[model samples]
Target: MKNTYFLKAVFTLILCGFFSMTYAGTIYLSATGNDSNNGLSMGTAVKSFSVAQGLAADGDTIMVSGLIDFVNDPGNTATTTTSGPSTTNKVGIVITKNLNIQGTSSDTDGFQGVDTQTFINTRFIQLTADFTLGLKNLKLINGALITDLTTVAAGGGAILMTNGAIVAENVVFDSNTTSGHSAISGGAIYIGGSNGSGKATSFKNCVFNANEGTKGGPIYIQSVGNGGKITFEGCAITNNLANGTTGGSAFYIRFNAPTGKPEINIINCTIRGNKVTANNANGGAINWSAKTPNTAYVNIVNSTITENTTGGSSTAGAGIYFAFGTNATGNYGNLTVSNCIVEGNKTDAGVASDMQVKADAATGTAPENTVGYIAVKNSMIGAVTSLAANVPTANITDATYYNYITTLTPDLKAMLVRNNPDDLKVRYYTLGDGSPAITFGKSTFLSPITTDQLGKTRPSTTDISAGSVEKNPVLGLRKNLDSAILVYRNANNQITVENSTNDYTGSITVYNTLGQVVAKTAATGARTTIEKSLNAGVYIVRLNTTAGSAAKKVIIN
Candidate 1:
């Protein structure tokens, strides 16, 4: 009886110990911390990241100091080569368990309440095992090329995720490169999976700049098996270079799975100024290739792909390239682009300066069985040199509008202007008046997106504009202003105000550009005719309602 009781007590104690280890306490890291400390609190923080890595377990949180050199290991040296890992290198932060590594800032200017200075100047993070990893509020820069020698998975100057889920938010990856030529890819990040396995990765509010690789200068995601999903939201990938024969200067995605197709969702991203500098390079901004019988899906919503170029006889897709394998049986890949602006992209070989979609074979069993398919809706393309049969004409304004009409140039410039070509952050192309892009979008899209790229609500659910910024009503009026009242001038130089909603009790006022009140009328309901015999010129008409007020520019002929 005593033996049984003792055994039960021992088992219970083991379970308790397991739970305690699994729920390990948080570890604090600082530049001035001592490596011999316990690292459980801010006072007893650890100095070296390597020591923290050894002490941390699954579900542990590593709170790094906001100091610039918190994780910038001086002992870690980066290699200049492209194909292999560093020689005199620190093994990096090899994460085998689920962890939350965060950079804490004391700066009041930061958005997250704390001004955490999370910058890593050297070394990279590698996720070798399958688990959930969260990295937030950090900047990774000047990381050397690191690769898995066995799998030939090179690149990832900042991070390499072989098989795991990663959520990276508010991070910046800059000035990282893989210089040599042995299948070097993913200058900033490399996500790889094989044998019917894949990973789910998401990047939110991240910036990748000046990273170089043979393919995917900023990011490379490849899946040899089934089910690889990647989402990049509000990311800026710019000024990256791809020097290999096959392109994707900013991003490369390969869905090589034979059974299930992988998916890539890019929302509100700006991919610009990336270049491909080799022969036969494709997709100066993005290169998507499907090598299996299954179909890979890529959805781009409310984004901008512009100013990317390809050189040295690269024949297609300066902004984007979609290709399918020859041996694929079913539909290989699919691309859905909505509410986007694709402009200023050029290719040296002169195929399509903006985008190119190709198949290994022209003939297929059915329409859905083609090598690849592209669907573009509510978009502005700089040029459409090919794939006219696949591209729809609904709510699509081509470069010809800008090329033919001189008066429309100002409006186009106002709507699609890149304020600064050099910097990616200040890039904004909002809608201006008299632009065909305004109120020309389709009522619905394949994706459930209700907001524009800038997080503004669409004025009309039925008729939204194209590109990232939706056109708001004049003078910050309510969206139902148009529905409430209608104003127009008749043949007798008299202004007619028609209120569709009987509940609208307001006053009508007209003024000229010089702030002089030309006419005024008090509404009594329904139709209110005001005889304002004024000279023929431009005037501003305003309606004041109990709910709100609306203004419109009218020309009296």
Candidate 2:
């Protein structure tokens, strides 16, 4: 029995050693190949990223040196290379595992993978299985092509992360292309599961810039079947253009309905300078949605969204458009935007009355607002125009109107709008000093407050809009006026008015709009209630005391 035990232990040691050796395979690729099978050593470097990928296993590493060219055959132009030729192919490298693909320099940026024009017109990186594709300290860019038609079709040029987990650290996605005008496309990085909740993906510390496509010019996440979850952290997505009217510029996450799943979380990211242009395009920095049971959970914390535009025949969010994945009735999903800055997003060409918040139904109609909800707490949100210009005053609680619009023409609205029903409310505090968005909110977000585009703490106590907060206590009533009103609302929407020089023991009189004394009461100790029938309109309520009187407008809706 002792001999048997010893043999077993020895066998286990041998197996561990073998497994470690297999996992330790690190193949290097460069402009020159050593033409040796010993890929574990740098001296025996492989010729291309494809050869390295073929030699790698699940957790292997691929170290790239010098300018390595990858060919992509999106159109299946070559009978020789299923992937692509080393010269003018469609895709350069296809990732199949949780491998670390890295470059030598930290300052330089270029495409870790490249996809060019092709006859078959396929995706740049078509991910068929589940894996983790990591691009470390590299750049991927520019997806454009001129096809048979007179017009040019562009996109689907960067990393494609489908049915798996994708991560890019300090990488850039820039110019590349697949089809011309007729391109079935995505650019930068496209993530999603199979049809029906089968894929999961995420990206961190990445940059997506100057990438163009028909839909999802920079990044697209389409999760079918229960949908999938996509998370972005410490990344910058900017200057990406999505062509056509309906495409989204920077990020477009859409899922199917009913059994659809949602798991979209964006944290500590910067999304700016992206455009969804002309015709039905959504120019927002990020457009995310979940369908039916699949709730698109978008949590943008400690991030900044600015200088993004969305417009054309119809327009929506310049910063973000959060909704239910399903384009069906009453299927609006859920959204939670906390600790972020969404400012400076606008419609095309100086359009007026662009809103910052818009909520509508899926079918591009109206009156099915129950499909989704938005909850924006402890954050800063304001617009170029006054809040009144965004929605009709009567629709504050007009559930029928919101529902009908969201269900009918969800995207046929004006510029820079946010859609958050009563279920999805926005709350935040004020900023200090010279800031535009000081004291400009109905509520205050409370979590790790979002910083500005330059990484400054968004003030939460005294400001109404972004880049503005009132910190000096010396300023009297106007100090954070919007926040003060919100605070009053927090106190059950009841306010007491009094002259600063008055005492509390005087009798107070209340009157109606017809100059009739509706009720009278004594100011007992410090407060008194006005007893009168109040309707849904604004009413001027006056309180009389020994030092004179004070009148204020109270909205009782």
Candidate 3:
């Protein structure tokens, strides 16, 4: 019996060692190298990224030493490449197996991942097969896409991902774009292809700037085949343009079928200065259309969406658009806007310019399919609304539909000296001295507050700021802010808000379950109370102060 066990263990070790020996190792690629070389070491590097990809096996590492330039390749013809999407045969590499593309340097500048020196220009990287792709410390610029006249399958100007998982860190996609054709989408990256098992797609510390596309300037996710989670953390999407009328200049996510659960998270990021230049475009930065049988979830937490612009005069959501397509009635979707600063945007959607909720589009989907569920809390925005079942846009009768569109006009640029390092094209909004966003974030709205984008330690729950940029306290309102401003029902059935903090002074409102304000009054001095006779019910008490705004639940007997 002891001899049998020892032989079994020895066999297992031999098998493990054999598998480890069969695993592919590293392959080096350089601009000045030759394809005839072995590509096994730095001295014997290959010239073409495509050649290196063909030579390597699954799980092989491609250590890129020199900038890979596709346009200046030695001898290649018949294939075409452009700065954006086209109907040409794109000259690029097709990734067929699992691999890692690592660059020489991985310098990070907050949301900006690239410096002025390192760059790699490629036409495209088509991932048609199911393979996990890992990219680190690399910049893909001027990547384009190709599509035939009929099929709309060719999207993703730079990285066309359809199957498997993609984990890219410290990567920058700049000036990548697709054509203005009505069928094409995704300027930088496109994720859509029937249940291809794309469950592990996440981008960390990435930057997407100056890209152009038809639907989504930088990204368009049609579907992921099965259950998938797409996340963008500590990233910046800026200065891109969406040429098509279907908006989402920064990102457009559309659900065509309920193939699987699709979730997208935008945490600790900045989406700014994007544009939708089409005549009837909406959602200057993001357009979300759970327009089919989709159970999707979108969480925009601890982010900043500002200065996004839409072209149409009657457009909605300069920062974001909650959309519904034809035949999208019975579908359900959820949006949570927490600890965000979505102000200073350009939109013509009434008083809510920063963000808009419009179930008003009539074409495309059935009228029964255009409604959704949304919650906007503890954020500074231009406007927000609620979502009811089977309704496009309904009255705010419940807590799910909420809005706090203030005219604070927070000083967003160069307000105070931030700890952000200099980048090649990095842009971040720093809250000025006494900016309203500085201690206006609601900690309980989402998760516990920890650090900001630049890795600044935040205060406790009561004193956190709203946007991704956490500011140092000039007044230090990050402690006991709730105790400084109190809102309660008086003995005479009146709503009273006592503000011991001088930074808070604006208005107070009392909303009942039926979405009607039973009482409202201007806030002034130290103690301000609204005299209103009320009955027994639970209500939502909201306070809009100069520094920021907050809401609470109150019960009156």
Candidate 4:
């Protein structure tokens, strides 16, 4: 009898443990007319998005029903109402735990009361605490807001993230705004790390449209109290707008360095139609303040930043702005552009500051003390047309500014030009044929199939300029081109070639900017090595492969 009782107790304990491990919290809310306290039944759901949020714990799930708006008056019968999404309702639902907030699939299951009009008045979500908020299969709209500056202060708008780790998946942040009052600005989403974690928040498979802020229209990541980490993966930020001086309409990463600093990583994302008006600083879609962090600063990898416009011809950095800082000297951070596309970012009348010159490049120039530092690998950076001839204005209205950047003045383009001018040193394989962002960046991994804002691959071959060199030259001009080419030349005018191709079976031809072939060489597979000297200039490489023909560009040191 004693043994049987002991066995029964053991069985009961095992069963309880199994149940606890499998159990997950569930909370149901309704934006529709129904209000039920029976949290278990769909028809009997809670009323407010906040109530459901307050009740959720770690590993819990919040389910919302009906169409509701935090800004607009729920009593309004018409969709177009004057008093829409207002501060009276903060965020629809804010989660601080590693929980999931999902919506029903039917039209009646989600919040449908949100619209552009309402988004102008309130914020949809503000995530600050440390936790992963997984939002899936839900349509979240009209979030974050910009109060009318004509009557109120320019500050106080959008979703502000002071410190925390967030995961926003398959979420939509649309029509959000923070109208600028001169310098005060707002945005759809604002993330900062004042706690110095350096890992702030991340957005995955998210969509941002028509969000507006004076600084960063769609999204802004700046150092707060402490530095944190911010990352964007497989996301889209388009149709974002800044008033005039702010950059990174789609997204911007700035290091404040108040105490600790933050790092930024943007991967597999698309940024397009983001605008920075004239009279603004670093109108390029993305601006790097280069403020020294207690630790490392900003890093962007495997992303696409294209088709962004600065308002006026006098503006600078339609693609990127690397602002100089004095408070933090050697603390200059690093900007690594790898396996990405950066095309169609243009500036006004004068050439936009492509890259800030550093020590070696800024020897005798003003601001002799270089502050900005950037590294480019296996990437391409050029104007849509040859910048060697005509300079475009900084405004988006100009046709020239509409083109991408090419023929950058290295002395003016960047602080550091890594790898080769014509080759992107980051990728293992080269891009091929008619791609706009050919060699725009170097990548540590293989390229993706998806195109950028301009619908071009991250690293396309056939660049107007020698952009990048990839690992595999299967289709492009590597077959007929020399695997090794000269990069830099010495004062003696001696040029050397370094063959770095996996397979070198193509002919080599050199050319000047005039499209005239200056030198030519023929080679067979029998001997895979060749040495030659040539003048410093741009050249083309055409290869005839057993499969077909292709072309690439080469630069003589």
Q: What TM-score against the true fold does each predicted structure earn?
A: 0.72, 0.61, 0.71, 0.63
Superposed by TM-score, candidate 3 places the C-alpha of residue 84 at a distance from the truth, in angstroms, of: 18
lDDT of 2 at 169: 67
| Predicted structure 1: lDDT | 0.66
Model 4: lDDT of residue 189: 67
> Candidate order by TM-score, highest to lowest?
1, 3, 4, 2
Q: Rate the local accuracy (lDDT) of all candidates.
A: 0.66, 0.50, 0.68, 0.50
lDDT of 4 at 192: 55
Question: Compared with the true structure, what per-residue lDDT tens digits does model 1 show for residues 1-557?
Answer: 99999999999999999989766678887767888999999899887765776788778888877543423453334444345545433335577677877885323111111112543233467776777788787766666564444445555767777767888887778777664454658888877764224657788878788888888888887663366778887777888998887788988887666566577888777787888988666566888876556777888876778778898443367887777646443236777777677766777644336666665543233343344656666666665444544443432333322222122231222245555555655445555443445544554752465666556666644566656666643322223365677778888888888888778788888877665678898876888888767789877676778966666567788
lDDT of 3 by residue, 321-352 (tens): 77653343433455667778776677544333
lDDT of 3 at 496: 79
Each prediction's number of clashing residue pairs: 5, 115, 11, 72
Candidate 4 residue lDDT tens string, 1-557: 99999999999999998986789878887665343375655676767665566666678887866555555433222211135533433433344566777776423444442446543245555566766566655655545443333443223243556555566666666666665254334466666545434444667667777777778777666554454566666666676777656566666556666654456776666565567765545546676665553444455555556556776442356666554434433325545555454554555444433332122121122221223444444333434322322221221111311233434441212112222233212111223332323322333333443333223344354321122222223223322233343233434543323344435455644444454665566535443222455666555544443433444555555
Candidate 2 per-residue lDDT, tens place, 1-557, comes to 99999999999999999987765567776546553555666677765566677777777777876645444322223212323332233442455666777877534533333333442322335454666666687755443332333322223565554455665666666654433443335666555455333545556666666777666877666553355566666666767787755556777666554454456777656666777776455436676645445444555654556567777522466666654423443334555565455655667753421223344532222332333555554343434232332333332321211211222332321122222223112111233222322222222432343443234454455332322122221111122222222111114444344333334356644444444555566665434554444445444444444543334345565
**Model 4 bad stretches (over 4 Å):** 1-18, 41-43, 64-68, 72-98, 103-120, 147-158, 180-186, 195-200, 224-227, 258-261, 293-295, 327-332, 348-371, 383-557
Best by lDDT: 3
Please give me the total number of clashing residue pairs in predicted model 4.
72
Q: Which window of ten consecutive residues has the lowest lDDT sum in model 2? A: 481-490
